[model samples]
Target: LLTPAVPTLTGLMLTGCYKFKAMKMDVIGVYTNKMSTDAYRGAGRPEATYLIERMVDIVANELKMDPVQVRRLNSPKPSEFPFATACGLTYDSGNYEAALTKALRIARWNDLLDRRARARQEGKLFGVGVSPYVEICALGPSKAMSAGGWEWGCVRVEFSGKATVITGSTPHGQGQETSFAQIAADRLGMPIEDVVVLHGDTNVAHYGRDTYGSRATVLGGTAIVMCIDKILAKTRTLAAHMLDVKPDDLTFEGGRFSAKGKSVGWGDLAPAAYVAKNIPPRFEPGLEASSFFEPENFTFPFGTHIAAVEIDRETGEARIVKYVAVDDCGPQINPLLVEGQVQGGIAHSIGQVLFERTVYDEQGQLVTGELMDYALPRAHDIPPYEIGSTVTPSPSNPMGIKGVGEAGTIGATPTIANAVMDALYPLGVRHLDLPLTPEKIWRAIQSGADDRGGDRIPEADRSAPRYTAADVGDGALQVGNV
Candidate 1:
């Protein structure tokens, strides 16, 4: 729908809202002080994405629009590079249309009706749901930072050639080690294993505010490159003195210095410079450098995801059958490591959708104390997922890279929850809270009943009796039943 006959109109399209076929010109109502927000996985995107996806099925049933077609109507086209969404984010680069198209093809969205018919013939509720989203990440640009504090990095390559990286960003799970090493080694032309990453020790890694806003890569990685440049400058002077050549005549390569095609290297020149025997008297024993880098703006990474599910009407239970994700984080430094980040993030979201939620009692006592009571999704809970991507390099850094650490968590939860609601729609359910427990789904399944609201909580399924502080010892417990 955004592909207008007049190119000027494309600039004003509300792509995300258009894609969902909904318009709320006054959505800023949720931003008030008291009820505004706090942090959670995926932040606000999870809630908004869930809302759109659930509404897709609802609108489909109401006006009979096919869910996929309804989505296609609003998807931003591949040609919309640097497109600006009404939310005020300039999507630097993306292929939203292709991502959605690929996701639907993989999900076999066209055959969903046939499968649903077969399932109905066999007495089951089946449905497919999709959510396409984008993440604005890699905090930076002093102006962006000034708006919300700033991110800082101080990279030092010691006199001993040992490296220590200090950044204001602290990572709890993102793999900064691997990424930092790649940046340092490639820039210095040293073996990757020789570069060491150090952070989180303010006394050692010393510097700014801290991580959490995903600022490490664009800011921190660029600082490593700057430090390498400093090291090369000093090393070149030392190399020129030892090689008996002009400073500009020497070049460093393969971890050594060469005099413009002459066969001598920096290793061969090191011993002479150390002894002051056959070399200049003013050179140092080892290479070292340090730097602090701050960029001009944050980069954006985006993607699309599709979730499919099956609901058992008899038990009111739903299970994710398949999850398909397509993400673009721009220029991967390590594909394997990137895939690991995406996969782990999706699992985190899956746990949130069907199993995990922080709960508190009326007395203000925390109810879910232990892992067992918290309802975490284990390995057996998630179905196999197909993860793929497309690259749309970010121009914010020389490496042309963007962050992938939180992309999966940013897009998967809503996709799964939306699918669950789609499966239960025929049962007269319009909305359901997350952690769709079987009892809640079963209650929704029986919403159309006139005689009874399904069976009462089977005594077996009622909340298991609660244990009190007086009921147990360190290694032994008292039980009334069993």
Candidate 2:
């Protein structure tokens, strides 16, 4: 709530670009009798998307408008880049409509009528929901944030032309190690195998803000690029001396410097520079450079996600049938890694919506303190994700790249929540809060109440299934009760 990361989820997207025409959000952070809420996964963005998306469905139900059409009507057009919102924020670049259209096509949204009708005949609840989300990344212009939002990088080339890169952003399973290495390799025109990226230790890694808020790649990788530019400049100078030509006349490619048909390979030039036997005057003996890059503005990465789910009315258990996501994080350096991020982030959001919840007793004692008390979603809980991307390079950055680490998490939560609400539409259920447990769903279904005001449940509302030890049986559905 207060002073948490991303104090406002996405005010620019909520007030500026969302097609709602009229919208207002009032956030009040209050000290709770329970555990203090803080950032997790997508942080505040997921919660905001969930509530806004749920409101969209609720309004759609009142107006009988197609949810997809409603979204399409309200979103900003592709030409609306640099769109300013009612809140004090600006969207850098996005094609929100394109992403939504891509997700819908991938999800086969237009063909859902027959599917819904067929499910109804089978006495089942099948619903589809879409969420278009925008995230502000790159940790930004620095002025907009309280923390020092800048990245540092250093690139060093040994006598053997082997490259080592040190970045400020440390990788904690987000593939920063590999991605930063790839950037160095590509920039140096060296084999990917020869490039090594180092981070996580203060002695080794540059002075960095560390990893969080999807800044590792967008900001950290850019810092690497900046440092490599310095390395390349030094290389060109030494190569000019070795090739016996002016540095301006030399054109380097494939890790070789050529001028006037005279060529010098990286291996030859690196050793010559370090040896300093025949090098440019006043030049350093080794090839090394550092860069501290400060972005002028934050990069905005936006996307759309669609979730199709099925609910078993008999038990109020829901299962995701299909999931499609179209994310645009600007020119992906590695598509394979981006795909992994999208899938993994979706899993994180699904866990938050369907299974993850923290509990506390009335006296403020932690109730769900252990892993056994918390219900994290398993691999089987997440359906296969159909992932797609459209690159719209950020004009503010040199690499035109944005962050995708949190995009999947930001877009998937509301999409799944919306789908679940849609699944229970026939039962007069408008919304149910997070960790949509079966008991809560069952209670909402049976009582026809929109019990979504808060996460606090009465003691009578237990977390376990309503079967006692005596009801345990081998063949039955546990005494035929749920």
Candidate 3:
């Protein structure tokens, strides 16, 4: 909002190129003086989201409103579909209230609040937090990419009912193999097992670049849709040739190109009739198609997450008691895959809020770079989570899907952090940093004396470092050296 001169880091970050377009709006940005950049896992979106949900708890404390009620009052209404926010991004579709309410029900929000109240009366600490998130993904078509220097995909499907999809998109473990195959199977009317998806090799694939920004489902899937259409078109032609019928007379369904109202299956006419007597005089017997799709706008997927925590005031340990997420990704292609994505994202979020961080020492050398030092949450640390979704078909795509990949992470971090903060609010604390360490929480409790009057500030709380660094003096670290 405050149109300061662009920072150099903006030029360095690929996402920063889109920041200029954002500045035309009429609001003030908090981090204007600092250089901005985008990292993997959509750091900017997640960070700001964490900040906002944290602030919601702050407001709830001040107004004495139930945190859930406060959030409901401030949240975007469901009627606000395709709504343009002050930030200039257009949200395609969402029902924010429904998602939030459903998540609360699944988490038993009221029951937890009662428990927390009882715990507080018994001089224990308990809290619950909810984070509703909206993220833009599935980057639009070629024109949208050209404007932001974003990449689009090129995909091809070959003849002989065998598909070789060459996608410009690459997967670093987002399950492109499973989900993309599902899309191809449904699109081509082929059994899910029959379709083959190819990606990641720049030599073989065409018109794509590195994958990030949660664009794979939107952009990459569009490319696949395009390729499938061409393959279907050619298959229709081949069907006409083999059935001695016009291309228009042949219809595709359930992996079979059939003459409508006839029992003959398209699979029954093999490469023989397709290549020999029954085929049209000039048309080829084989089938194939390829294309580049450019969408006009980005798809926005939204969701809500709720977390319940039990805190030990003595040790300053916060344990998750319950978790629930209600998401709407706009017509899910695979329900099980969507559930997995949500669960994985939530785990990452919980890790960030409670245990995970990257750090460096005064000399700016990498420390805690190894997994032994880097804390990732294990299964034992996580409580069971209940997940549910609502289907709102996207108007933008023919397939009606919006990406669900990052929803849980974007929603869970703040939810867990807020719950922890709510549990400690009675101890007279307001703000804290990520990875809410036991030492940090214990110190905060001890340093906080009975409040006499006005708020206190010591420039900043400097004792709680962002993260710990390894003491690797002389450019080396040693363990139990035998």
TM-score, cand. 1: 0.77
Q: Per-residue CA lDDT of candidate 1, range 221-333, in tens?
A: 67666767776786677677766789888766776777756634434544444455554465665454556666655677777788878987788777888889988888887
Better of 1 and 3 by TM-score: 3
TM-scores of the candidates are 0.77, 0.89, 0.80
Predicted model with the maximum TM-score: 2
In candidate 3 the C-alpha lDDT for residue 130 amounts to: 74
Which 10-residue window in model 2 sums to the lowest lDDT? 473-482
Error of 3 at 405 (Å): 2.3
Ranking by TM-score: 2, 3, 1
Which stretches in model 2 have alpha-carbon errors above 4 Å? 1-6, 10-13, 16-24, 449-482
Worst 10 residues of 1 by lDDT: 473-482
- Using lDDT, rank the candidates from best to worst: 2, 3, 1
lDDT of 2: 0.77
The per-model lDDT (C-alpha) reads 0.64, 0.77, 0.65
Give the total clashing residue pairs for model 3.
3
As a whole number from 0 to 100, the lDDT of residue 279 in candidate 1 is: 47
